[model samples]
Structures are given as C-alpha cells and as structure tokens.
Target: MTFYVCIKRVGDILLSLTAIFILSPVLLVSALLLLCTGEHLVLYRQRRVGKNYRPFNIYKFVTMRSDSEKSGTITAKNDPRVLPVGRVLRKTKINELPQLFNILFGHMSVVGPRPLVRSEVDMYPEDLRQIVYADNQPGLTGMGSLFFRNEDDLLAATGKEPATAYREDIMPIKGALEAWYRDHKGFVVDCKIVVLTAWAVLHPGSAPVIESFRNAPGFPEKELTDYRTLLARTE
Candidate 1:
C-alpha cells in the first residue's frame, strides 16, 4: 500500500475503535431494543461486496421484518417491513452503527464507496463495475451515501416499483457518484465526506451537502435533474 493508504487504514482503525468505545451505550441500547422487537434479532448480517470484490457479511441493527427480503431487497419510504422502533433507528441512522466493527476489522474504510450487495454491484453501468471496487475498500459511508441520503423517499417519489426505479434511475447515479469518489479519493476529501455524513444524519436534505461535490466526475446532470424533480413532488 502507498503511504497515504497506510495512513488511512491506521486512521480507520483508531476512529472506529474510538467511535465504538464512545458509542457503546447507544449500541447496547439499540441492540437490546432490537432484540425485544423486530424479529427479536439484535444484528442483521447481510453479504456485501467489499474491497477487491471480496464478499463479507455487513452488520446492522435489525430494522426490518425477518422476511423482508422475500418481498424485495429495495427498501422505500414507509416500507411496511420496517418495525416501529426501526423507523427511529433508520431515521437516526443508529441501525448502521454496528458497521463500526466492520471498519475496525479492516473489511471497510472510514470513507470510500459504500459497499453494495452483489446484485446491486451488478446494477452499475458495465463500464463502472470494475472501476468502483478495484482501488479501495468499500466504506460505511461515501459520496453515493451522502448524495442519496433520502434514497428511500426518492424511490417512493418515482411512482414506479421500487426495484425497477432503483435499477433504472438511482443505481446509475450512485455508480457515477462512486466513480467520482474514486477519482477524488484523498485524506481531505475523505474527511469532508465523514463530516457531511454526520451532518446528513442531523439535518437530512441539507442543501450544503449536495453543493459540496456538485462538480463530481461523470455527474449525470439530466438524471440528477429528474431526481430533483421527483424529490420536489414529494415535498
């Protein structure tokens, strides 16, 4: 690995460990709540494509019914599979805290492209499929995660089937955003993404986050315009 890559890995370890230590109480409470509710499962582990196309199980607090995937993998606004407590967890993004462990274990980075299920990875434009995961480890959050922060709402606004809309619209944009991150990957950019992710949790739909990286490489302008139009309909 290059010097900066080594530094980033070290940073991921320190930050993830520190986060886990500081957030232990919240993590414990979230686990207990999940155990008592929603299929009585504490952690939900799903297989995801990680660095260099390696597959690993990603951890999250159980936020949906056990049988949720039978209906579809794509979750949209007010998805019925979501439990009552899940809404809070998902809304506050507490459900994803378990992924700190993924970062600590070196399966992911503090900032890079968010990992995707194998199927979702396949949905990327063929040209981008090899490019996205080849250079760096997948992340707990990244440009795609930030830009599509309200993805569930956006999918709902499409007025089309969730999976269909995602495949045709969101996936391509996500691929482009990930590609942008690949090109712009660096210490400062990663730090900015980490800050933006935290801000997104506190203030969803904040315009500053969108403005932060408006000049991303291969940014799909027409598609983004259509997405903004769709989001406007919901408001």
Candidate 2:
C-alpha cells in the first residue's frame, strides 16, 4: 500500500475502535429506546456499493419503519415515516453511529465518499463511476456528504417526486463532489472534512460557513450558492 493508505488504515482502526467504545452507552440506550417505543429493528442494514464496486451491508441505527423505503427511497422533511426518536437521531446524525462497526470491519473508512445503494450506484454517470467508485472506499463523511447534509430538506423543497429530484438534481451534484474528494484524498483533506462535518452537525443553520469550506475546483459553485440562499430563507 502507498504511505497514505497505510497511515489512513491505521488511523481508521484506532479512531473507529475508540469511538465504538466511548459511544457504546449511547448505542445501548438508543437500542433500548427503539425496542420500547415501537415495532422496529434497532439497527438497519442495507446493501450499498463500496470500494471497487463491491457490495457490503451499511449499518445504521433504525430511524424509520422496517418497510419505510418500500414507500420511497428518499426521506423528505416532515417525513411521517420517521418516528419521534428517529427525528432526533436523524437530525443529530446519531443514526449513523453504527457505521463505526462497518469501519472496523474494513467495509468503510472514517472519511471517504458516502456509500450509495445499488440503485443510486446504477445512476452514477460513467466518468463518476470510474473516478469515485472504482478505486475508493465509501466513507462515513466526505465532500458530498457534508455538502448535502440537509438532503431530505433539499428534496422536500424541490416539490418533485423524491426519487426524481434525487436522480436529476441531487445525484449529479453529489457525484461531482465525490469526484472532487477522490482527487483530493489525503490525510489533511480527510481531517478537514471530518472537522467540517462535526461543525455542520452542530450548527445546521450555518450554510454560508459550510459553503465556504466547499470551494473547490470542479464543484458546481453556482448551485451551492443558490442552495445556501434557500437554506438561509429556511433559517
């Protein structure tokens, strides 16, 4: 392995294990809460395209009914399928904590492109598929993930069918952003992405700040700026 990959793998193992240990209590409580509140699984696992276009089960704390995606793949704002506890988990991104296990198992990296389902993968334009998916492991957080952190809200605002909006409007942007990260992948870049992701989670209203951090070549600057305006109005 190259020096970067060697160091990154080491860091991933250390950080992921530490996080799982520290967050075990939260994980347990969330699991208990899910069991007490409804008839749903505490953890949700679904197949997502990973590095080399390999398939792996991505895990997350359950945020919706077992068959919620049967109705639709995208979750819009005020999506009724999300349980009350789920809303808190989703908004706080606590729902993603279970992916720490995926990281430990080498199915993911702490910082890389966010994995997409097979359907989403199938829609990736040819160039993006070769650049972003063929050679990189999907991440817990990365450029595309942080840029579209408010994905459900974006979809809700479109007034188009959720899947339609995602395919036409959101997916292309995500593809570009992921492609950018693939080019810029490095220890320093991953650190910055992780820090920005934490900042976005804590300050969901800071669109301008988030947008500033995303200034990179090949990104659709105009679209991000427009989305920032939309986010500002919502705030």
Candidate 3:
C-alpha cells in the first residue's frame, strides 16, 4: 500500500478503536436515550456512495422518525421529525459517533470527502466526479462537512425548497469543496480538517479560511463573515 493509504488505514483502526473504547459510556447512554425516544431503533442506516463508487449503509444514531424522509430528505432547522433527545444528539454530533464502526469495518475513513446519497452523487459534474470517484473512502467529516455544518439553517433562512436549494445552490458548492479536498489530500491536511471541524462546532461564527472556501463559487458572503471578527480574540 502507498504511504498515505497505509497510515490512513492504521490511523483509522487505532483511533476508532480507542475512541470507541473511551466513549463506551457515552455510547451506552446515547443508545439508551435513543431507545427511549425512538421506541425501538437505535441506529439509523442510510445508503451512501463510498470509495470507488461503491454503496454502503452508513450508520448514525437514530435522530429522526423512521419514516421522516417521507416529508423530505433534507433536514431543516427545528425539523419536527427530530426527537427531543435526537436534537441534542444532532447538535452535539453525538449522532455521528456510530460511524466509528464504519471506519473500523473499513467502510469509511477518519477523514476524507463526506459521502452523499446516490441522488446527490449522480448530480456531480464531471470535474467533481473525477476527484470523488478516485480511491478515497468517504469520511466521517471533511471540508464540505465543516463548511456546511449549519446548512439546514441556511436553507431555512432562504425559505427555499430544501431539495431545490441543495440541488441548485448547496450541492454545487459542496462538490467543489469535496473536490478541493481530493486535490489536496494528504496526512497533514486530514489532521487539520479534523481539528478545524471541532473548532467550527465550538465557534460556528468562524469558518476556516481554507482555499476551498476562499475559492468556492457562489459561497454566501454574509455567511463568510459570521465569525470573522472573533479572530482578534484568538490571535
């Protein structure tokens, strides 16, 4: 295996195992809460396109009604389908923790382009497809994931149909960002992205001024400045 692939697999295994071990208690508590709130299902699995254009069931902690997608696939701000406990899980990203199992099972990576559904991947422009379809496993988090962390809010703010807004505005931007990550793939970049994700969650106002975001076509300008002023305090 190449150096990048070797380190990535090793890191994914070691880190995922360690995280699962350390967070066992948290996972247990979350599972119990999900059962109580969701009545039965604890894990939510959805088909996502992964490396080599293969499809796999991506797992997350159940946060919405089992049939919630009947209304729409895209979640909105204050989405009613979300259980009260699920809301907290989604906000804190505890819902995403189950993907550690994905990494361990070699279905995903610790960091890479976040996977999308078949409908979304089918919409990728040729230039974007070349990058995403290359030999890279989808990630638990990535550049697009971090940038679009508050995407539901943006959709709600615009009052646009969620799917239409995503197809016309959001998907294209996400494709470009994911393509950027593909071009810039490296160990250092992966580590930086993971750290930046945590930072973004804590400081939603401050988007990381990465090349991808700086060059993203049609990225919202006002959204960019949401937390730029906070830089003074950090510096």
Best by lDDT: 1
Q: What does each candidate score in C-alpha RMSD?
A: 1.6, 2.0, 4.8
lDDT of 3 by residue, 52-164 (tens): 88999999999998889788677878888998888999988899999999999999998988888887776666567657747879999986687777777666655577777
Higher-TM-score candidate among 2 and 3?
2
lDDT of 2 by residue, 91-154 (tens): 8899999999999999999998889887876566666766777679899998778878888877
Instruction: Compute each candidate's TM-score over C-alphas.
Output: 0.94, 0.91, 0.86
- Tens digits of per-residue lDDT for model 1, 1-235: 7998999999999999999999999999998887887688888899999888999999999899988988868898888899999999988889889999999998998898889899888988898899889877999899888888788888888899888889888888788778877887888899899898888887778477766666765666765676567668668
Check candidate 3 and list the clashing pairs.
205-227
Minimal lDDT window, size 10, model 2? 205-214
Q: Distance from true position, residue 53, model 3, in Å?
A: 0.6
Clashes of 2: 0
Candidate ranking (TM-score, best to worst): 1, 2, 3
- Top TM-score: which candidate number? 1
Candidate 1: where are CA atoms >4 Å away? 215-227
